[model samples]
Target chain A: MQIVTNNPLVREKLQDHYAVDYAEGSFGELLVRVRDKAHLGYRLLSHPLSGSVKPNETPYKSVLISDGPGALDVESLTIIENSILTADKFPVKYPQMSAKMRADFQLIDYTLLQSAL
Target chain B: MKLELGYIDIQDIQFSEESKIANGVLYVNKDEIQKIVLGQEHIRSVEIDIARPGESVRITPVKDVIEPRVKVEGPGGIFPGVISKVGTVGSGKTHVLRGSAVVTTGQIVGFQEGIIDMAGPGADYTPFSKLNNLVLKMEPEEGLAQHEHEHALRMAGLKVATYLGELARNVQPDETQEFETYSIPEGMEKLKGLPRVAYVLMLQSQGLMHDTYVYGVDAKRSLPTIINPTEIMDGAILSGNCVSACDKNTTYHHLNNPVVMDLFDKHGKEINFVGVIITNENVYLADKERSSDWTAKLAEWLGLDGVIISQEGFGNPDTDLIMNCKKIESKNIPTVIITDEYAGRDGSSQSLADADALATAVVTGGNANELITLPKLDKVIGDVSYVERIAGGFNGNLKEDGSIVVELQAITGATNEMGFNRLSAR
Candidate 1:
C-alpha cells in the first residue's frame, strides 16, 4: 500500500513506513512507502490518523490506490504500478511555505481508490 | 576532481586611503584599478563608482558583471586562457567576495547591453541589484572598432575582478561549499542503478561581437566536447556574448551557474550527474549541424539517460537550441531545455526561432518582448542619455519625466535562460 499525502505533519507522522525527504536528501513528501503494512495497521489503530487530507483546491492532487492484504497477480500489479506512475500529482518535493500562505498551498480535490480485485 | 569555494561575505564597499577588507567592508584603491584598465591601448578613460544595495541609482548600457574570485591553491589563476596562461585549473581552494561584483558599463557595444537598477520595482528582476557593485564607467578611444572596444572592456572586467579577488588570499572564508566529480569508471560504479544525466551548456558564439571563450580558445571554433563540471566552478567558461541584455549569460552568471548548482544538489541521489557538454550557437547552418551532431554523439557515447540543456541569448540561437534537443532526443535520451520567449508584447507570437514536438519539457525564463516602464531614479550611474538606441528601446523611449519605457529585453539578466529568476509567464 502506498500512501500519498500533502500534509507535512501527516507525512512526518508516517515516517517509519516511508523515507522522509530530509533523511533522503529530497524535498518531496508525496510518496510514503509501507515496508511493514502490519506496522502501518498498528500505527493507524493507535494514532489519530488524519481521515482525509483532502484540500478544497490546489495546483496538484493525487489518486491513492489501497489494496487490503493478499499478494496481487503479476499482470494486475504491472497495470496498477503503471497507473500510479502515470496520471499522478506534481512530481516535486514539498516546498517550505509559511502559515500565512494558506490559500496558496490548499489542495482542492482528491480521489482515494480501494481495490478488491 | 574536487574544489572548495571559500566565500567571504562583503556587506559594504568604500574607497579609501588603502585597499583591504576590514570587518566585512571592502576598501578599494581606485588608482590601482584605473591603471590596470588604462593599460589597454584602445580604452581612453576609466571612471570608477560604487552602487550599494537599496540605493536610488541605475546603471545602464552595462556589458558584464563578474564576481571577483582568487584561486589561492589551484592549478591555474582565475580567468585562465585569456587573462592568465591557458593552464588546466579546477582543483584546490578558491576565495570569493560573496556579496560583491564588478560591473562593466559604458557606451553601448551591441544593441544588447543591460541596465541594473539599484532600487525600485525593476531591481526585483535582475540579480545584480543585490550585490555591492563596483561600476567601471569606461570610455573608448575615438573611432575604436566595436570588436576592439568589447575586448578591452571584457579584459578590464576580468583584470579588475582578479585584482579584487587577490585581497581575500589570506582572509578566512565565512563558509565553504565543496564540489567534486568522479572519473567515468568510478562514477558509473557509484551510480549503478541511477539514471545517467548530463548538462548540455550551449554558449552564444555567433561573433558579430557575440562569443564565449573556453580555456583561452574561442568556443565558435570548437566541436561539442565534454568538460568536468568541477572545472566550471574554477572559471573555465567566460562569457564574451553581446546578445540582448535580457538573456545573455554575463561573466557573473557563468561563475554562479544555477543549473550546475541545482544539478550538483542531487548529483549522487536522484540521478547520476555525469558531466557537462559545452557547445556553441553558431550562425551558419553547416556549423549548427556539425555542433548538434557532435553534442548528440557525445551524449549517446556517454550512455546518458537524460540531459538538461540550457541556452544563451535568443533569436538565431533558438535554432541551435532546437537542433541540440531534436538530435539528442533522437538518440533516445530525454531532454529538458531552458529558454526564454519573444512571445511579442501581447504574448501571441512564436516563442522560438525553431520548434519541435520533441521539446516538450521546456522551462521558460519569461517573455523578453513584454514591455515595462522604469521610474526615473535620483542617480543615474552610467549614462542612460542614449537609452533609445538599444535593442528593445524605440526612438522616444526616454520621456520628459526622465522615466523610460522599453521592452523587458532592455534590462540585464531580466529573463536569464538558466532559470535564474522567479519571473515566468502563464
Candidate 2:
C-alpha cells in the first residue's frame, strides 16, 4: 500500500533498479534484517520512529536481536511493506521474459513510469 | 474583263483537299467567234489553259469581252488542256475527264499547280467536278500546295484530338465531352495598340469558352509551327493560336527554375491551366525510379496532375515486397505497371505469388502505360472484378526506360480519396 522507497535520492535513480534479495518466511524476519542493516535503514520509507504498536497478525512479534524498546525503526517498516508486496516484482529477471512481457511489466511498475499522467 | 493585274509571288502553299493529290483529263471547250470585213479579217476570243489532255473548261463571259486574262498558281504552272479532238491524243475523252475532272466518291480533291489553270474562257469554264462532287468527294481547299505551317498545325490538331478521344473513352463519363473551338475575334480596334492587353483578353475569352477547356499551342506568335485545338471541351477540334500541337514532347515538356504557375500568373489571362504534362524523354527519365521512389521524384520533376510509375521486372521474390511497399507508398500519386504476369490464382505462379502479383497489378495497373501481357486473367482475378477493371483501364505503352507516364484522370474520379476498396476487392 505504501511506497518502499521514499528516500530523496531514489527519485534521481528512478530508471535504475534496486535489489533487496531476501528469503522471508514471514514479515517479522524481513523486518529484523532491515532493522540491523544500516544500508536499508538509510533508504527506508517511514514517518519518524515511534514505539506504538497496532494490533495485527503478530502483536508481540519479538525482536530477535533482543532490543526490547523502540525495536521497530524506519528500516523495519520498509522491509515490512516490501515483504507484503514481494510477489509483485517490478524488475523481473530479464532473460525469463519476452519483449512484450517486459513491456507489460514496465507498464505496471510505477517507478518505470515517465509520468503518472 | 478580268485581266491579270500582275503575278503574285507565292508566299506559301496550302492543300484545298483533306488529302492532296489530283488526277484527270482535258479538252478545248471554248467557243470561237470570228468576224470578217471587206477582204478577209478575223477577231475571236483566244486563250490558253492547262488541264488533263482530253478535258477542257468552257468559256463564259463574266463580262462581254474578246478574251479574259487569267493567272495560275500552285506548286507548278498549269499543264495544257486537249486542243485537237482527232487523234490518239484524244482517244479516250471519258478517261481523260475521269482522270482530270472527276473525283471518285469518298475521294478528296488535290490540285497540282502544274496540271490545271483557270484563264480566259478556261477560267470561267473550268469544271472542278471534284470540288462540287460531295457524294463522291469532299470540297477541295483553295489551292494544291502544302505549307509547312499548315501541315504542322493540322498534325498537331489531329494528334491532340486523337489523344483526347482516347482519354474520354477510357474515363467513360455519363456524358461525353467535346473539344470546344477557340478563335480570336477579328481585330479588337480598341486594343489594337495594346498588344499585351489584347493577348490577355483573348486568352480569358478562350478559357471562358467552356466550363473546363484544355488548349495547347506552339510557342510561336504569328506563323505557328504546330497547333492543336485550343479548347478540348467540344469535339477536340483545332482552334485558337496553337504553336506546339505536334511538336511532341517539348510542347508539353516542363522545366525547372521558374515554376509553370509563375508563367501562368503572368500570362493567366492568356494561359489558363490547372496542371501540365511534361512529355520530353530526358525530362521523363530524370523523374523515373522504381514505382515508390519515382512518384515523389516526378511530382517535383514535372508540375503535374499526377505522376505515374511503371515498375518493370516485378513478380520476383527479392523485389516483390519492395515493389509492393513502393506501390502502397505511391497510393496518392497515380501509377501504372507494365508486366507480363497476371498475378491470379489459376495463373502459372503459386497463390502467394499470385497474391503479391495481384497487389502490385491492382496498384499499378489501372490508368497506366502498360506493356504487360497477361495470360488467364479471368481464372485468376475472377470475371469483371476490380483487378479486371484495372486491367481493362491499362492501355498505355511502356517507355524505353521501362517506366509508364499516364494521365491521372485516366485512373480515377477526381476526389482525394484513394481507390483502395475498389482496387483491393476481388
Candidate 3:
C-alpha cells in the first residue's frame, strides 16, 4: 500500500498534509498511475527516470508505488488512517515546494490522490 | 407530506395452496396467480418460478424488476393512474415486501432485456441477483408488435405486483419508518443555515420502446416539472423504457432510488432538501433544449444553490445531460451529474458523447463497455438462444459450455446511474 520516492524533501513538505511512508519499487509504477489519471505532467518525469535523471532532480525521481496493504491504490485513493494524502486535486504540483537540502534523497515523493469530495 | 413505510421481510417464497405471508416467507397459490396472469388480455401465459440468494439460477431477457407494495392508508393506491385511481399519493401508510421482487422475462429482444444471475461472478454486478425474485416468464400472444409486447409485459408485471402487494396489507409489519418533509416556507426556516439542494430525476423517454411514464402520461410528451419525491415512493413514476439493462431505472429502482434516499438521509443535517424536479430525456433537439431550459428555470425558481441530476440511458441522452448541467450551472447553480461511461474494452475511448467544462462535479456509474465472462450456471430461467445478438453480446458470446462473455451493459443495473451499486472505475 505504500508509494514513495527517494526525494525526502517532497516527503518533508507533504508531511504537513500527508504522512509519506515506505515504498519498495522504482518510480515507474507511480508514473503509470499518473499517466492513467490523464495527468499530462507524468511525461515530464518519465525521461529522467531512465538513467537520465539528473542529481537531485524532479520530486518524483526514484518513486515507487503499490496499493493493497498499507495504503490506497492512488487510483481508488481510499482514505487510509495514518496516511496524509486526501482526494481529488493532485498533490501540490512539483517545483512549488522549497527544500533547504536538495541533495537529501531519502524523502518519499508527493502523492496525488485519486479524488476527494 | 409524511409517509410511514412498513417493511415485511420476506426470506423465502414457495407455492402453496393459499397465498399468504407468514414467518418471513411468502407462500403463493400457484393456480391463483397463474389465473390472474392469464387474465391479462395481451398476455398468452405466465410461468412463475422462485430464485433465492446463493442459488444456481439465471434469469435472462429480464424486462423489469418490481417490488410489490400496497397502500395501507395512503391518499391513493399504488401504481397510480395505471392501476390504482389517479389521486395524489405518497402520504400515509404503505407496506413493502422488503427482500422480494417480481422480475418479468420473456422472448424480448436480446439487446433490450437484462440478465440476472442469482449466484456467480455476474451476480456480483447486478443488484437484482440478491433479491428473492419471483420470476415471471410472461408470454405475449403471437404476432404482437415489439412495442405492444413490451407494454403487455410491463403492465402485466405491475398488475401482478399490485395483486401480490395486497397479501401483506393485513399482515402486521416487522418494522415501520416515517419520512416527513417540511413545507416550502417551513423548510427554509428549519434549515436556514444549510444550503438548498434538490434532485433532478431524468426519466428515460427516448421514443420507440424506450420510455418512462408519470401518472400514465409518457414522460417524453411532458414538460420538465416538479414532483414530491415521496410520490415516487408510491410508484407514481415507473420504467416503461426498453433501454440497456445495466443503467435502466426499473420500477424497483424508482421505488427505492438511491439518490433520493441518500438526499433524504442528508436532509436537514447539512443541506436543506427542498424538492424533486422530474425531467425527461427526449431525442428531439427542441425537446432537449426546452426540457433543460425548464429544469434550469425551476431550479432558479426554487432558489436552489445545488442540484444532483441523474440520467437514464446513454448516447442521445448524454446531450440532454450536458445541456441540463451547463444551463443549470450557467444560472449560477452548481450541479453534480451522475452518469455511466461507455469507455471501450481497452478503456481508452471517450466516456460521454457530449461534454462541457461546466460538468466539473461528476459522479460516474463506471464504464458500460467493460467486458466480463459469465461462467455457466446450473439453470437458465429463460431462453439464452438470443445471447449473441444482445446489445453487449458478440456473435460468439454464448459458448458451447453455456457460459457467456459480454459487456457489463448486458447485466441489469450493473452500472446504474442512481449509484445503486458500489461499482466505479478510477
Candidate 4:
C-alpha cells in the first residue's frame, strides 16, 4: 500500500514503513493526484473523503491506495472524481493558522490515516 | 426491553455553596466540579460558567455537550462501560436532568469544534441554545498530545455530567415517559397486522478525534449489530468524535435521539417498531463493505418492511448511507434517509458525496453551507479567536465590531441529520 498525503506528520512518521508520497499543495491538489493515480489502476484502499472534516476546510489530507497497478477500478475513479467536485464546491479559503492549530490538524490527519491502515 | 425516563425539569442553574436541586433550579458547587476535572492530570485548570437561554452569550470551540442522567432503577448504570461498569443497560428507569446540559469547551482540538450562541440569529440554528448550559472551559497541560487531550475532555464532561445526574437521584421527576422494544418473535406476534420497521443508525467513527463508543468499545471495531432502541437512551452510545460541528452527534443527541423517540411515537399505532441496527462509518473500504453487508443481512433477517436510516457527519459517511439504503431497498424494504446538505453557498452543488437511484425518499436537514451572519453578543464564554479556523468559518469571519459571519456549519446542531432541528428543505 502507498500513502498519499499533504500532511507532513503522516509523511514524516510513515516514510520508513510505507510508500509515502508527500504532496506539497492544497487538500484539493492531493485529491487530484490521487485521481491521477486511480486513472492508472491504483485501487483506492480508503475513501477519499475519510474524515468528516470538509475538503477545503482543512489544508491537509491523506489517503491510502494499492501499491501495484491493476484493472481500472471504476468505483475508485468515481469516488475520487466526486470528491474533487465536492472539494471544489466549498469556497477556497486557506486561512492562516497558528503553529499549534497546524499541529492539531496534522495529528488528526495522521490519526485518521492510521485508523484505515 | 423497556426503559422508563423520568425527567426532572431544570429551569435555571446557579453556583452555590452546596450542590442540590430545588424548585426546578439546579444549584451546583463549583469547587466539586473543579476537583473532578482536575483529577485528570493532563488538565491544568477548569472554569465553570453558566449560559442560560436568551442570554447574549456565545460559546466557541465547544467540544461535547452532555445531558446529565442517572440510572434510577436499572440493572446497569448510565454510560455503561465508560463511567459505570460494563453491563447491559436499557431496562428499568433512568432519570434525566432535562433543560440542562454540560457544555465542554477549551483550546481547539481540531478545526471541527463549533459555536453555540445563546441568543441571536445564530441561536436559531443550534438546539443547545435553548438549554441551560453548564459550560466548562478547560485548559489542558502544555505539550499534551491531541489524542490524550480529547480523551481528557471527553472524560471530564462525562464525569461531571454523571455527578450532576446523581443530584436528581432522590428528587422527584417532573415528567416520566416510558419506551419499550420487544424480541423479534414477540413483536411479530403482537403487531402482526402492522408493518415492521427498523432504524439504521450510522455512527461517526473515522479516527482518534472522530470516534463513537458503544458500551465503551470503539464503534469502528464493531460490526453492524441489533440493539434495543432504549439502550441508546440509557447512554449505550457515546460521541467521542470531533467531526464537523453542525452534524456531529453529541452525547446529548444520543441520550435523547429524536429518531428513536419519533419512531416510538408511531410504534404499534402506525407500524411495528422492531429494533435499532447500529453501524459505524469506518475509513477502510473493507470495513465499510463488511458493516453495510451485515446491516442489510440483519434487516432482511428481521423481515423489516420499512427502515429509517440516519447518517452522522457527511462525505465518506454519505457512501455508507447510500450503501445501506440501496442494499436494504434491494431487499424490497423501503427506506427514508435523513441527512443534511453541503450544497455550497449558492445551494447549487450536490448535497451528498454519494447517491443512488434507490435512495428516493429523503428528509433533508437544510444546507450546512448556507451562510449566516451573527450579530455580536454581550458576552463571549470561550475564546472567539478560533472562529477563523473552524469548519464553517473563513478568514476575516470575526469583524472588528465583534459580529461574525459564517456558514450554518459552524453552529452546533445547525443541521442535525437526526431531524433534531427545524431546518429542512422544501
Better of 1 and 3 by lDDT: 3
Per-residue CA lDDT of candidate 4, range B151-237, in tens?
A: 999999999999999999999999999998788899988888999999999999988878999999999889899889998998999
TM-score of each: 0.77, 0.17, 0.78, 0.98
Q: Write one digit per residue (lDDT tens) for candidate 1, span B1-426.
A: 888999999999999878898888989999988998999778999989999999999998888899999999968988888877888878999999999999998663323347899898889888899999999989999977666788888899899998899999999999999888888898889778888899999998755346789987788778889998777776789987655688989888888889889988998888888999999876444567789999999999999999999998765567678889999999999999999987767777667656789998999999877888899999987778656655566667789998989778888999999887546642
What lDDT does each candidate get? 0.72, 0.21, 0.73, 0.90
TM-score of chain A of 3: 0.27
CA displacement after TM-score superposition, residue B195 of candidate 1 (Å):
1.4
Candidate 1 residue runs with Cα over 4 Å from true position: A1-117, B108-112
Interface RMSD of each: 25.5, 36.8, 23.6, 1.2
lDDT of 1 by residue, A1-117 (tens): 334444444344444764322222121222233223322331111100111111111222222233354553332233222222321221222233235233222211111111100
* Docking class of predicted structure 3: incorrect
How does chain B score by TM in each prediction?
Answer: 0.97, 0.19, 0.98, 0.98
lDDT of 4 at A42: 97
Candidate no. 4 TM-score: 0.98
Q: How many angstroms is residue B218 displaced in model 4 relative to the true structure, after the best TM-score fit? A: 0.6
